[model samples]
Target: MRLHFHPLSPYSRKAMVAVRLRGDAVELQEVDPFSRGLRTAEFVALSPYGKMPVLETSEGPICESTSIIEYLEEQGPAVMLPPGRQRLARHWDRLADLYLMAPMAELFWRRDTPLGLKAPAVCRKTWGLLAQQLADRDFVCGDAFSLGDLSAAIASDYLVRLGLEPPAPVAAWLQRCLAVPAMAWTVELAEGHVQRFLKPLSAEFLADS
Candidate 1:
């Protein structure tokens, strides 16, 4: 399997973490979607959306982080998502939907815009939502690490890096997740992937924009 992704993208990070945790064997290929370097005519034939973190699995191409994670868990030796409380899965999904995807979308767009141009009130609101969501939980879903925890961690890692720390419970949770052998392995790999690949690419894009 060949996984196409951008190292810095939280979505791509989720898929990578899932694959690593599940012990799935696949090749990671860095793809620049915005640069139009990927999604050549051939690539588009595989995934019409032309999104990053596309998994070219033995069965077929799986796009989107959640889908790729499900695929890995289904095919691999270990499972990242636990099976119980279907409502909890929904809860985890909602947390990711609310905290990770929404706020990060704002950050991504605001990358080119100056802080002055960006809405301070909106930024505060978003961060507040994140902190509030994190107030009670060890993981996004529960005690054990799940896909929710992995995705939220990667997304929240961005804010933490930017100096917005999670509330007490969430901070402890983040530390717990980080300390896991599976997550630690991914983070070790991710640190180099981000330093050597992602940060430079993001800096170049922001500079040019």
Candidate 2:
């Protein structure tokens, strides 16, 4: 399997975390289809939407992080997510897409958009909502780590980058997730990508450290 991902993208991070936690060894390729002159036309053909986190599998190319994760879960072992609660798990994953990832994407994209002036307010609001939704949950779905955990953790890194730490429950949840060896490894890889994108953001994340 080949994964084409942008290092700074939480969506890509989601797929990476799922693959790594499942103990699968796949080739990782960094691509910047968004950068003005970064990617080739051939690569763009693979991702007509010009987005990162495209996974090439034995069957075909799967776009979208959630789809990639589902494919991995269907084929791989270690069962990062639980079975029998398919409906609930799907809803949680949708929540991650709508609530978690959408807000972060807004903040990240606006930094270079016309709404850049309102980025700070948007970021603060995003963090506040996240703190509320994550009030007392160890993971998005439950105590056992799932794809929801990976999505939330990667998205939360943006909160820390913006100099906003989640409230008690969320903070404790994050701490516990990081204490897991697989999660820690994923976080380290993610932090490096974040640092490369925004140097001060990385420093700000470690301010309270």
Candidate 3:
């Protein structure tokens, strides 16, 4: 199977972490989300949404980051989540997707625009809510790691980049999550992607416009 993604995409990172943790023999394929190539009929055939982290599997292509992660979970021992914590996992997943992904997307057009400046404050609020949830738990859901932890790990990168500190417990949890080998690798790959890879999209889009 091939996982199409860019390391900078939190959604993609979430899926990648699950794949690596599962020890699945899937291949990684970099897809530039900023490029019009994603809109071409060919890629769209695989993912109707034409988004990253689409999994090309023997059964067929799986679109959406959450969907791909769920697919990968079925391939192995299912350690990415603890039993009965699926609801909590889904909650965190939605939190990240709704809050973080939106602002990260603004970096495309608002990378230098006044609108972009507004994103961080909005994002910080969401981070506070997340921190409140993690006040008593080491991980997002609890003591055991779950998909929620992965979601928070990815979303919190925004706060880190902004140099904004989450609550003490949330900050501690972020450190612990990054210490995991798979997550460490994910963060390393994601480093500088915003500056080097994704920021260029703003220029490219303006030129095309």
Candidate 4:
């Protein structure tokens, strides 16, 4: 098995974290989507939507970060969607992808636009909900790290880069999540890509602020 991904993509980082947590032996293929790598015919055949983090397996290719993680769960030990906590894990994963990551993407790409300008407020409201969820537990679902932590942590990392750090409770939770070795590795890889991608835009983003 081989995973094709871009380090800068939170969705890609999510799938990568899942693989590492599960101790999967999949090979990594780094693709530069910004360089039109996803548009090539060879790559499109693997993922019709031309998305990053496509997992190629013996059976076929799996697209979408969540779908890739789900496929990997079936193929090996279920470290991510643990027993008795699958529902909670999936719930927070959905919320993180929708409320945290989606808005972060909007803010990154369309910061000067009206919707982009509103993204930070949306993220703050989501952070409140996440903080409430973490009040009694270390992880989103419980004490153990799960799929729910992956997406939210990655999004929060980028939010910090955008100068929109999460509030105290959520920020502490983010720190706890990143303390996991796999999460730390993924975030470190993402940090390099993010710095390179944001370097040229730093002045523009500062001026907009």
Best-fitting candidate, scored by TM-score: 4
The 10-residue segment with the lowest total lDDT in model 4: 198-207
TM for candidate 4 is 0.92
* TM-score on alpha carbons, each prediction: 0.73, 0.77, 0.82, 0.92
Give the Å error, residue 26, model 2: 1.4
Could you tell which candidate, 1 or 3, scores higher by TM-score? Answer: 3
Error of model 3, residue 136, in angstroms: 2.1
| Residue pairs in candidate 4 whose N, alpha carbon or C atoms collide under 3 angstroms | none
Per-residue error (Å), model 2, residue 101: 1.9
Which regions in candidate 1 have their CA more than 4 angstroms from the true location? Answer: 33-35, 76-78, 108-137, 190-209
Clashes of 4: 0
Q: Model 2, range 1-209, lDDT digits (tens) per residue?
A: 99887667778878777777787777999875456423567666666676778888889789888888888888856366677655556665766576656666655554445454344455456546556656666665566777656666666667556555566666777777678777677667767666666533344333423
How large is the C-alpha RMSD of every model relative to the true structure? 5.4, 4.7, 5.5, 2.5
Give the winner by lDDT: 1 or 4: 4
Clashing pairs in 2: none
Each model's C-alpha lDDT? Answer: 0.64, 0.67, 0.75, 0.85
User: Which model, 2 or 3, shows the larger lDDT?
Assistant: 3
Residues 1-209, model 4: lDDT tens digits: 99999888889999998888899998999998878999999999999999988999999999999989989888768899988988888998998899889988987777768767677777888899998998998888888999978788889888877777678988898888889999889878877767766522255554454
- Write the candidate numbers in order of decreasing TM-score: 4, 3, 2, 1
> Which prediction has more favorable lDDT, 1 or 3?
3
Candidate 3, residue 161: Cα displacement in angstroms equals 0.9
